[model samples]
Target chain A: MKAVRTIAELREQIGEMKAASAKATIGLVPTMGYLHQGHASLIRAAKVKTDIVVVSIFVNPIQFGPGEDFETYPRDEARDLAAAEAAGADLVFLPSVDTMYPKPTKTKIAVSEVTSGLCGASRPGHFDGVTTVVGKLFHIVQPDYAFFGMKDAQQVAVIEQMVYDLNFNVTIVPCPIIREEDGLALSSRNVYLSPEERTQALVLSRSLRETKEAVKTGQIRTAGEAKELLTQIIGESPLAVIDYVEIANFPELSPLAAETAILEQEESVLMALAVKFGKTRLIDNCLIQPKGE
Target chain B: MKAVRTIAELREQIGEMKAASAKATIGLVPTMGYLHQGHASLIRAAKVKTDIVVVSIFVNPIQFGPGEDFETYPRDEARDLAAAEAAGADLVFLPSVDTMYPKPTKTKIAVSEVTSGLCGASRPGHFDGVTTVVGKLFHIVQPDYAFFGMKDAQQVAVIEQMVYDLNFNVTIVPCPIIREEDGLALSSRNVYLSPEERTQALVLSRSLRETKEAVKTGQIRTAGEAKELLTQIIGESPLAVIDYVEIANFPELSPLAAETAILEQEESVLMALAVKFGKTRLIDNCLIQPKGE
Candidate 1:
């Protein structure tokens, strides 16, 4: 395994690899370091699907807001390198901020509609930063396939649209959301939660699981009712403060009103939420594939 | 040269080309296809610099305004194919409008600053359209080098910024302006000019040349003075009506006051203009690199 710290070195290494094996299929797993089981899953999946797996770890500052956790974002390169290699990442690209952004960037890739709701509305300019870095990474790696965890469902949707819009050659493989046995979604930010706050965060996944069951059993008829139930569940935890509880049509993310009852013929819908447990903000979601579609 | 129309066919052909020669450097010359001497110059340049040249003939409708000439824009695949071949192109991509835009496109690639003045100000969303189509073409062709005629100086500037911002793995080569014996810049729209209007169109390039001379000789120190001189020269033609006459610092296109006289230490400036001869609009520009220290 190789660790490349510069774009030039990364490209050269990939180019040399291509020269060595012209038919090799390269896969990329892009992450912002502090590797957890979720990133390992993506890397392991890449290993199966591609001859070469490249994992990029860069804590992108552009994706964070003024008061966000960019300053306090975790970093442990030696640990990350070992974890990535163990998970079968053939090369680890660990680029510095200066290399990623050499100058004040003036070009922005904007996706509308899908980007307007969810985290897009809460943290302004967040998706753009994600798409920009992902786009840059895609070009640099020129991967045959790129793996993205479904934990960031909206991020996957935005990237799908960007790839379709820009006609990128790589295929985006969306992996299933990896969660703890206790139902908490795996995230680097999960480390930010204190012990008490960590237990309270369980409300997020519990609500989602309950809602998925209700949705399947037809107990929840409308998107509005689902939102109310989610809000109620998360609100009960004294440490939890709700940011948003949204139910939108799957993929398109079209908003559903309180009065917009779930249809008997509806196949799938998405339920997502964000809550602040102390200063640590966590997000989670689940897709409801209604029964008897 | 071979011509491929469908995106699938083009991609397949390019894939085969790569399979044959893994290290070949492809060059692209994107054009709207009334293939004038200007486009031929770009194609010729590509032939010299690249192992394979792909000239794309796409009359992008998105770049034209609602009442603009998109519907009536000139196209001739046979003539263009012949012209491109004559200029030593290896392949010609002649995608229909339907193929290029199969559905309503929601994504756009936008470049700022350099796209703010001159034609960008006169025609809203025009540069976005250019960048979008060119971006699509770049992805389809995956060229190592792309050529653009400097006749559309701001277009070149906008594309340069977009390529840089997006970190496209392509180098932009801005070719020199190709002109006629009477100094009229070669453009596909030149066909729209009536003989009398064509004669009057000389004022566009004439003023640009005169301004270049004035700036070089230090006779026009300030951007304002240069604009006045250009306006006066074009206004003298009874058939000419000015659209915009802008003098801005090169590349950046920053605003410079009319009273800010020329300085001995000045290195570069871009003087550009758009004028209407009857209903036909024509544009021309010159980049002045001042002599002496």
Candidate 2:
């Protein structure tokens, strides 16, 4: 992969690739530079549908809170380059923080209702960070489609709603979460977990899976029951602490107080949660469909 | 001119136009449907540079306050259509308010510092409305360049700042304000003025001209003097009630205080004022460059 450091260089590279390509479509898979299987899946998905794939490997500073590993966010340029090449990416952009966010960046793209809920509830400006950085990436890359992992379901939904509302000319494609053989979702933050906390992290994916299974078997009737089942399972895992449990409309992300009303539109319920396994906060989600017609 | 009412149809037309002629750039001029010479200038400029020119006539509701002219804003389709054809516009889009802003448009694209001042000060959420509506137009039309008149200088600056900060993929073209032969700027709201107020409204432009003269002969040194001159001019005109007099940064629209030190980076100054002559609010501006070394 040709690693580009400046936005102009990256845009020039993308422009050249677009000019030379048959499809003329540009895809972006933005990440913070630790290329794990989750990142790889997004890149692979992007390569399938678009002619030119640009992978941004910037560790966005605004996304990280003051004490939240902004400095320690991993950067392995050689490995990331190799991975992007293997994933069939046409360009790799590694912009300097200065280039992406100049000192005078006072403007922000905010999606109001959906952002104030979910992890946004816990992380304060987390979704704002996600949106603002993603917006910059979208503008710089000018991608026809952007690939994101469904593991951050709320993030994906927030991004989709933002695109729909803000009129960004990009499609958001949410790929299923990439997982380990034992079913733990793959994340770069997984590196921060201790061996014991890593084991305890299984509760997140396992609880989501069990709730999905219960809903399929009619053991879960309402959103409350489905949430309760997951709650009980997660409570049993001594090492995990719950942050929020939500089953919400796909677009609005408003938690369903009653059983989800009929899905009139192309809407599904998001069964999502964030849990603290030791000091690392891990999020997981599953989509809930209505009973078979 | 081909008239389109639906956003999907407008986008489809823009898409086909782009596909057929990639180098045939598009220039968009967005307006509320009250075609005047000021709007004609923007359409003419767009006609000069691009293969296709689109004029979106949407009277955005979000920008208006209660008791404001949201419902009463003038709409003359016959006049507008003739003017657009005369100006060589390829298409005229008169989208319905509901079509432009669907229900629950919670996403607002805002330029923070620039918006918080100026018309933003007197009219809350005005720039947000401007940014959001223009952003929708930018997405739906996907114009290579968009035009705005210098009469709405703060709005043009806010838009330029938004395009820069949000990384919108379009060049903002700030066209010169088209004026009547009387030195009064042409505006759609000019129709609301009574004959007597219409004559007195000339004070707005004349004050700006006099301010230029004052600064030339060293009568005005600071922004305060320029503001004071504008206020005194309106005060002398019995029919005119001053709304605001602003001396600000040319691009950022940040308020300039006389006591503040002049930094080298802050060179251009914008002097704008709004005065109500009867039911109509007349506005005008003059840009001043700093003294030479």
Candidate 3:
């Protein structure tokens, strides 16, 4: 398990690997270092789908909001590499800030509708950071496929849109979320919890699952009811401050008003939620569908 | 020269060419069809510097203004090929509007400071179109080097800034402007002119010569004086409606003001002018330097 520290080093290794085997498809799993099962799931998915899997570990500064975890984002390089190796990744790239952006880069990819609505509304310039850094990673790795965790569903959507729009010629594969035994979404920020905050954070994932169940069993009338129930669930946790609970349709990401949208689009009312536990903002979601369809 | 009509075909040809010789270096000259000495000059420059020169002939629709010549841009494949082969181009790409765009492309590249001034101020969304289409062309060709005519001087500067800011690895080579015996800048739009309009269009080039003479003879004191003389020169032509005549710092594209910008920077100032003759707008420029420097 060798750790590559620079963009040049990663590019050289990938180029050599490409020369050795013409059919050696590369799969990239981008991460912000502190590894958990959610990231582990993404690595494993990439490993299974491609000939070589490269995991990038960078605590991206641009994506962090001013009041957010820019400074305190957890990083454990050794642990991350060990976990990546355990999950069957062939290479681990840990680039310095200079390695990622030596100078100010002006090029950015933006998705108009999908980006402006969800997390983008809360974290200004956050998706811009995600898009820019992912673009740099995509260029450096030159991967055949890039795997992303659906925990940040908006991020996955943005990257997919950017890839399609930019003609990058790389496949964007979205992997599923890996949760705790309590149905709490696994995140590196979970460690920031003071046991009580950890417990409060579970409300986000739990309410989402409850909303899914409500929709599944015909307990909810419209998307509005599910939204109300999810709000109430988080309100029960005193320490949990909910930011937003949105049910948006697939790809278009428009707010789900009823079971159907205009244009007879294949609508997906993703029950997405965001809640703050202490200083850290955690996010989670579950898909809800109409009873018959 | 082998013409590739689609990106798929071009990519396949590139694969075979790369396999045959790893030492082969690809150069690209992107142009709209009706090839002239200007296009040929770029192609010839590409042939000298790289092993494989691919000339793309697609009149980009995005770059044309609403009432501009998008509908009337010239095309003649046989004539273009004869010019391309004579100039030593190895591959000629003549993709259709569908092949180049396929659909409405969402991705775009923008250079803030450089593009906002110059022709950008007049042609709304023009440089955006150039940046977007050239980006796609670079992706498709994946050339080692790309060539452009300095006749579209602002376009060269915009692309240079974009390539630098975006970390695109291709070397940008700016070729000298190709002109007719009478000093009019060669352009595909020249074909649209009546003989009288064609002769009147010579004012665009002649104004630059006047500015050059004024600066050389120490008669011009400031940018205003130079532009005023140009306005007078174009006013002499009955059909020529003067658009703009100004000198500016090369990459910055800032007007050469006596109070603000130092005379030292005037060495890099580009004297660019645009004129309209009964509908067709023509642009040209001359690079200025300080006297005895």
Candidate 4:
């Protein structure tokens, strides 16, 4: 495995690799460092599908809002490098703040509609920063396939929309969300949670799981009912301050009416949540397919 | 020469061409049909520098303002194809409005600072449209070198800034502005001019040339002095109605102070104009290099 910290070096290295094997398919896994099981899962998926797996680790600052955790975002380069290589990344890109952005970026890539709710609403300009940095990574690597985790489900949707709308040549491969044995969604920010808050965080995934089961069993027939049930379940935890409990159509992310029947809708439904346990904000979601004909 | 109207076919054709020659360098000349000597010059430059020359003709609607001439924009497919071939183009992409945009695009690429003034101010969202469509073309063609005419000088600057900021892998080659013997800049919209209006349009280029000569001879010193001379020279034409006469730093497109000495600036300076001949609007510019050490 090789490591690079500059854009020029990464391009040259990718070019040389492609020159040696003209038909080699490249895969990219873009991430902020402090790699956990979630990131490793994405890298492992890329290893199975591509000839060259390049993992880029840069904690882009622009994505964080004014009061967000820009200064305190977790990062561990040494651990991340080892984890990326062990998970089958052929190359790991570790660009510094200065290397990634010598100057502030004036160009922005925005995907509308899909970016209007959920995490986008909770944290403004977050998706713009994600799309812009992802765009830069796409250009720098020119990868054949880019892997993403459904852990950031809204992010996956926004990126897919951007790729489709922009006619980008690369394909987006979305992997499943990784989770702990107790069903708590794996996140680097989980490290920030106090021991008590950590246990309460499991309510997020539990509520989503129960909601999916309720919809499947026809007990929760409408979006409003589901939201009410989720609110009740998450409300049980004292430390879990609910930021948003949204039930919207998948991909398009248009809000569903309160009385809209989830099982009758042709498109898939997304039940997403953003909750704060003290200062750490954690998000999780599930996609529910409509009942088939 | 070959012609393709759909994105899929163009991609397949370019793929086959690249497969045959692994090291072939591709060049792209993006235009809005109605090919003239100016577009031909761009094509010819591409032929000299690249192994495959692909010219795309798309009159992107998003770039036009509410009352702009998008509907009346001139187009001649047969004539354009012939001219493109004659100028050494290997392929021409002629996508229809539906082909280029099957649906309203939700994604937008915006470059700030460089697109804030000059034509950008006169035509709101114009550069955004240009950058978005051009970005789509860059992904679609993945060309090695993209050729552009200096006729739209601010456009060149905006694109260069986007490519730099976004880390697009292609090089932007700015060709000199093509002009007629009478010093009139070549434009597809030239077809809109009446014979008398055409004669009057020559003032656009004439004023630029005189301004360039005056600055070179040290007769024009400050930005305010140059604007005054340009406004007065172009005022001689009875049919010409001034829209804007701006002097700004090149590429940055930031306005120069009224008293700022043009010759002392280290960066190249741009003197740009937009004027209406009856109902037809035309634009032109001249770039002045700083005195060398």
For each candidate, give the TM-score of chain B.
0.96, 0.95, 0.95, 0.98
Docking level for model 3: acceptable
Tell me the TM-score of each prediction against the true structure.
0.96, 0.94, 0.90, 0.99
How should the candidates be ordered by DockQ, best one leading? Answer: 4, 1, 2, 3
The best candidate by DockQ is 4
User: Across residues A111-196, which tens digit of lDDT does each residue of candidate 3 receive?
Assistant: 56668877989999898788877876776677889998888888888888777666776899988888999888888988888988
Computed on C-alpha atoms, the DockQ of candidate 4 is 0.88
State residue B13's C-alpha deviation in candidate 3, in Å. Answer: 2.2
Candidate 3 iRMSD, 1 decimal:
2.2
First chain TM-score, candidate 4 = 0.98
Model 4, position A250: C-alpha lDDT score = 86
- Candidate topping TM-score: 4
Which of candidates 2 and 3 reaches a greater lDDT?
2
Instruction: Please give, for residues B9-79, the per-residue lDDT of candidate 4 as tens digits.
Output: 99999999999998999999999999999999999999999999999998999999999899999978999
TM-score of predicted chain B, candidate 1: 0.96
Report how far off residue B286 is in candidate 4 (Å).
Answer: 0.5
Q: Write candidate 1's Cα lDDT for A1-293 as tens digits.
A: 99999988998999889889999999999999999999999999999999999999999988999999999998899999999999999899998888888876777777788899998999999988888888788878889999999889899889988888878888999999999999999999999989999998999999998877777677877788889888988888999999889988777788787877665427557788989998998999987665434
Q: Candidate 1: what lDDT?
A: 0.87
Task: Give the per-residue lDDT of model 1 (tens digit) for B1-293.
Answer: 78999989988888888889988899999998989888999999999999889999988989999889998888787888889999999989988888888876767787877788889899999998998888888878889999999988888888888888777899999999999999999999999999999998998888888877777777777778888999999988999988998877767787677776555326567788888887788888888765422
Model 3 lDDT on a 0 to 1 scale: 0.81
lDDT of 2 by residue, B1-293 (tens): 69999977888888788779766799999999789988988999999888899998889998887777788888899999999999889999998877876776887777788877667777888888888889888877878899999999989888988888777789999998787899889999998988889889999889988887787677766777778888898788899988899888778677788754223224778889888886677788888776622
Query: If ranked by TM-score, best first, what sequence of candidates would result?
Result: 4, 1, 2, 3
DockQ of 2: 0.68
